[model samples]
Target: MIIEQSHFLFVSLYIFAISIGGLLLNRRNIIILLISIELMLLAINLQFVIFSVFLDDIIGQINALLILTVAAAESAIGLALLVVYYRIKGTISINKINLLHG
Candidate 1:
């Protein structure tokens, strides 16, 4: 089985579409929104790796690693904020977040 550039592009597009749908339609759930953001990041990372492989370039891999690190940090900070919000508000609903006056 030989994988081509088109295959990578198709898969990346599919992931991006699903992630956007998740972000737009699941606005009430903060966790789903966070997961969707991660999915989008993964899709970008996939494209980076695919292009790097096809072009024999190391910069793409380095860029992907940087993105991965940023994604990890983002997720960690987001989850920590979510936990604090849940502890203070007792709910994880995005709609209810605005009740915090500060």
Candidate 2:
């Protein structure tokens, strides 16, 4: 049990670290943004699994599946938005976007 629990903790922490790193590295590159989003999703999934294992409950697994579906939808929407932005501005820099009109 100790080994299994430790493994779960290690995996969860690793995923969290990757997600943080990805977000920190976000830049004008749309690909990096997408990757960061993916890493964040992966981290959530890892936590769900770890908790599910710790509690010996199926709900965690179910929640993890739901999270994956949501993540996919989010990525699709985000990519679509990025495409629209790029088409309009000819660049994907988040810093340059200021479409809000006062």
Candidate 3:
């Protein structure tokens, strides 16, 4: 079974689209929003890897690693903030988000 770049592209596009859809349609759940954002990052990473392999270049893979690192940091910070907000309000619902004010 030989896999082509187009197949990887379609997979990446599908993941990206689904993540975007989840981000837009999900309003009340902060966790879902975070997950969607992570998925988007993953999708981008997949594209980066695919292109790197297809082109036989290393830059794309490096960029993907950088993006992955940033995504991890973002997830950590976001989860931390969410924890604080939940502690203060006793709810994780995104009814009102004013972390600084709270």
The superposed Cα distance between candidate 3 and the true structure at residue 27, in angstroms, equals 0.5
- Candidate 2 scores a C-alpha RMSD against the true structure in Å of 2.4
lDDT of each residue in 4-102, candidate 2, tens digit only = 777877887887788788778766776787877788788778888888888989998999999899989988898898888889989877678788546
TM-score of 2: 0.81
Q: List the residue pairs that clash in candidate 3.
A: none
Which stretches of model 2 miss by more than 4 angstroms?
A: 1-3, 100-102
Top model number, TM-score: 1
Distance (Å) between predicted and true CA of 2, model 1?
A: 2.8
Taken over the whole model, the C-alpha lDDT of each candidate is: 0.94, 0.82, 0.94
Evaluate residue 57 in candidate 1 and report its C-alpha lDDT on the 0 to 100 scale: 95
lDDT-superior candidate, 1 or 2? 1
Clashes of each: 0, 0, 0
Poorly placed runs, candidate 3 (over 4 Å)? 98-102
Mark the regions of model 1 whose C-alpha exceeds 4 Å error after superposition: 99-102
True-structure RMSD, every candidate: 1.4, 2.4, 1.8
